[model samples]
Target: MKKANLTKIILSISACVLIGFLSSFATRSSVDTWFLTLKKPFFNPPSWLFAPIWTILYILMGYSFSIIWNNKGQSRKSKEIIKNAMMLFGIQLALNAIWSILFFGLCNPFLALIEILLLWLMIFETIKAFKKVDVYASKLLIPYLVWVSFATILNGSIWFLNS
Candidate 1:
């Protein structure tokens, strides 16, 4: 891809990130209350870690998507893979945000755990699909998958301990 094209993709990804963040704004107060009162796992990192970790992961995700977007796959198989990948990507992102809403906005750790588990599965399937198109893109998702798996455990732990 040309420099200009790369710039456009990155900017669009950033906008997506911003929009994702903003969409959860109404729940911020609840997040503050619920997050602070939570009985976190012993392995849980400080709250400050989330922003940076997610920012980097989002950048990697954007880069991965760009690879798919840049592909000129006139082949039927390639087209199907891209279409499925994009759809799964969107679903996983929605799940990610919905987990936050379930946990913080509704103050329901149990439901959040369920949502996150599904999110993890979606992400794994997405990576599997992306691999057929670009190996590097699949590799880029490893950290995200690992982090969410860890998070799933952490979410369960919190719910168990708090209950």
Candidate 2:
């Protein structure tokens, strides 16, 4: 790859990873105090599992974004299509970060549950938009989608059990 393209990929991956670490601030602060006391569902995985899983997910998310970003548009219409897809990608990424704040920072499972649903929808929309740019990029997000789907269930279950 060209140096410029390599730089873009690295920057994209770094940005995504940074966002993930920023989001983790909430979880890190609350995990020992607030989160430890929560009434998690029986299916909830061990605490140590989240960090590595999220790391992998964020890496995949960045790679997926880069694939779409690197797609060369042949026309104005195509460029517009790419632009819209990137917008969706940004929105979903922001939503992903907000979920950590809502659930861990604010310590509100109910509110988190609501926000997670929105996050889930945004992810689905992002996948659809990315599909228009690159099918493989869209495919890359399936694990993220599946993980978030499972998280939504877990969050809802936690809300139900605790409330």
Candidate 3:
């Protein structure tokens, strides 16, 4: 790979990881304190699972986004599509972080559930936009979409049970 592409990949991954790091500030304190007191569903995964899973997901998301970002468009229309896709990517990423803040920082499962629904929608739209730019880039987001789908269910369950 060219140096430029490698740099992009690293930067992309770093940015994603940085978001995770920042979001963890909200999560770390609550996980042992507030979150532990919540009424989680029976199927809820173990606490230790979250960090590794989120780390992997963030890496994948960054790599997927890098693929879209590095693509040089062949025409005006193509460039516009790529630009739109990137914008969607940014939106979804911001939503991802916001969900963490709402749930963990504010200790509001109900609000988190609502925000996560929007996050899921944005992720779906981002996947569609990414497909227009690069099929592989879109494919890379499938795991994220699936994970967030499961998370949506989990979040709803938590809120329902606790409310």
lDDT of each: 0.79, 0.90, 0.90
Give one digit per residue, the lDDT tens place, for model 2 in 1-163: 2112676677778889999999999888898999889888889999889989999998889888888788778999989998999999999999999999999999999999999999999999999998888888898899999999999999999999999
- Candidate 1 deviant stretches above 4 angstroms: 1-4, 23-27
What's the CA error at residue 132 for candidate 1, in Å?
Answer: 0.7
Cα-based lDDT at residue 70, candidate 1 = 67
Error of 3 at 9 (Å): 0.5
TM-score of 3: 0.96
lDDT of 3 by residue, 92-162 (tens): 99999999899999999999999999999999999999888778878889999999999999999999999
Of 1 and 3, the candidate ahead on TM-score is 3
Instruction: Put down candidate 1 lDDT per residue, 54-151, tens digits, no spaces.
Output: 77877777777777666666899889888888788778877877877787778888998999999999999989987877788778889989999998
Measured over all alpha carbons after superposition, the RMSD of each candidate to the real structure, in angstroms, is 2.3, 2.1, 1.9
Once superposed on the true structure, which residue ranges of model 2 sit more than 4 Å away at CA? 1-4
Q: Could you estimate the TM-score for every candidate?
A: 0.89, 0.95, 0.96
Q: Which 10 successive residues of model 1 have the least lDDT summed? A: 1-10
User: Number of clashing pairs, model 3?
Assistant: 0
